[model samples]
Target: MATDRRDRTPTADPPATDDEHAAHLERSRRVWDRWSDWYGTSESDFEPIREAAIDRLDLQRGDRVLEIGCGPGVNFERVRRDIGAEGELVAVDYSPGMLENARARIEAHGWENVRVLRADATTVEFDDPFDVALATLSLSVMPDIRRAAETVYRSLVPGGRIAVVDIRSFPSGPARVLNPLVRRFLRWYANWNPDGGVVDALATVFDECEVVDTHMAGTSYTVVCEKRDAG
Candidate 1:
């Protein structure tokens, strides 16, 4: 088994005072801006999860897709492929550095049907509704999970699908009972992203939802949601 440092290291950041948390978000933006230079090197870890999202979406030709917080544009091509050669894709992320990576990927691939934007995920607005929307691991760091989920809901067309994959304090079934403990231990680790829990926060916004155990040593999960008629 390949033991990845990002996976094995804790996910919860140290306890942050409101000021510390604000400063951290600012630092996070700068760090990822620098990471744009090394974006491609991070693709290996992204492939599987990207594939999972594509497979689960099961899109058709000409489908319109929206990706929130699309770091380094890792999944743009895959989503385009899923929608077929004629489909359209719109990807947004808050970091200019990350958007730079995303733009490079799109340009490198010569994908003419894609649009990239440097904007916060919570406030992204699409020109038109999409057939499907994805937040692939991006919402895990969101400061406002419910608001973000609502924005996703409003961005989609009727009966459109939305999927979010994120990391949790624990991995699976009965073992998940230890999340509180795991969360406590991880709080002391560096790089711990302690944004309030997304899974629970999003439950109030979607009508149909399902969660599945994913990769990274079963430490992460994917949540698939369907927009309601009224939502």
Candidate 2:
């Protein structure tokens, strides 16, 4: 079962007011801005986990996809390859520094189909519905995971697919011993709270949700779901 393990050291309770949420958002943006340059380099080891998430996306040559919190565009190459020249990839990040890296990556590769925008995933608007939506290691950091998931769900067309890969609290037993160290590492590096209720949030928005434990003794999970037709 999933547990709520949000970091209590930083704030004992979740934000209760708009001002508090705004403050947390600003702090998170600043953290990512400072870490943008080293973000990709630091996460090199987790490339496979990201690849696994993208694989489940099952992108096709002409599919339009939306990627939330696409820091440094780490998934760009694989997404580009799968989506091909005909498809469109819309990537959003709240951090300008992160978007800068993503833009640079796109320019360097001459990928015309990929567009990077600086916007908060919870409130960003899409002109067209997407065929697929993906969020890798990002949902846990959102100011409101449920809002973000709902936004993603609304941005997708009926029958559209969504995938989310994120970290959660470690399971009990020997793995429980490593929680403190792992939590500290995540807090210092990504400002993530593993108790964000990501899976629960997704379940509320998507018609069907499937979760797979991806790594670190059930500390990470991959969720795939499909939007059902309104009819």
Candidate 3:
């Protein structure tokens, strides 16, 4: 069996200082911009998992949805289908190149209900609340997972749902042996940390959380959460 290149790795660097964090964000944006084209074509293997995450959102017709780190708008069609013509989909990403690709997709498909915005997921705010929010294979790449999760939590209306899918470190087992090669591949291609504490971050903000393990020997996990009533 072939192994995915997103398994266990070394620990991520400690939390960044304000200035250092800003620089890291900028670098990440630039890297995605450079990789936008290839990323869109090379990630076919992740499509099933991505679609599974979207399905867990349980979106309804006319629902307002927000997608963070929506690279190249890969999930646009599926989301549009779920939400229908009356619904709205907002796809946000920090990389201009990636957003450009997403825009092209929207134009080609004539999906007027879909909008793409260029912004950092951690800092962006929405004036209107969303019914559902999704972050697929993205939370691990965020500069500050907790802050990003908080932003998403606040952007959703009470009772809204949020779903996140991301890579995680493999537990001790035969799979552990593949860690070094997988880590090297991820570091070289995307600068992503498999063990980025994404689940813990979401748990801090959501009223309830359900975790599901997927892919090779649980190399990745998805978390689905529901917003609690504001007291």
Cα deviation of 110 in candidate 2 (Å)? 0.7
Q: lDDT of model 1 at residue 77?
A: 74
Models 1 onward score TM values of: 0.78, 0.88, 0.88
Provide the lowest-lDDT 10-residue window in model 3: 1-10
Q: In model 3, what is the error at residue 24, expressed in angstroms?
A: 1.5
Regions more than 4 Å wrong, model 2: 1-16, 178-181
Q: Clashes in model 3: which pairs?
A: none
Model 1 TM-score on a 0 to 1 scale: 0.78
Tens-digit lDDT track for model 3 on 44-158? Answer: 8788888888888888999999999999998999999999999999988988888999999999999999999988888898899999999988888888887788888889999
In candidate 1, position 49 carries an lDDT of 73
Which stretches of model 3 miss by more than 4 angstroms?
Answer: 1-15
Error of model 2, residue 45, in angstroms: 1.2
lDDT string, candidate 1, 1-231, tens digits: 112222232343234466765665565577667667776786777667767866777788999998887878878877877776688998878778888778878889889999888765666677788899888767766555666777888888878887777766755677788877777654432233555667655665665666754666677777777775754
Better of 1 and 3 by TM-score: 3
State each model's C-alpha RMSD to the native: 7.9, 5.2, 6.0
Q: Residue 9 of model 1: what lDDT? A: 26
Q: Write the per-residue lDDT of candidate 2 for residues 157-186, one digit (tens) a residue.
A: 998988888887686667787888888887
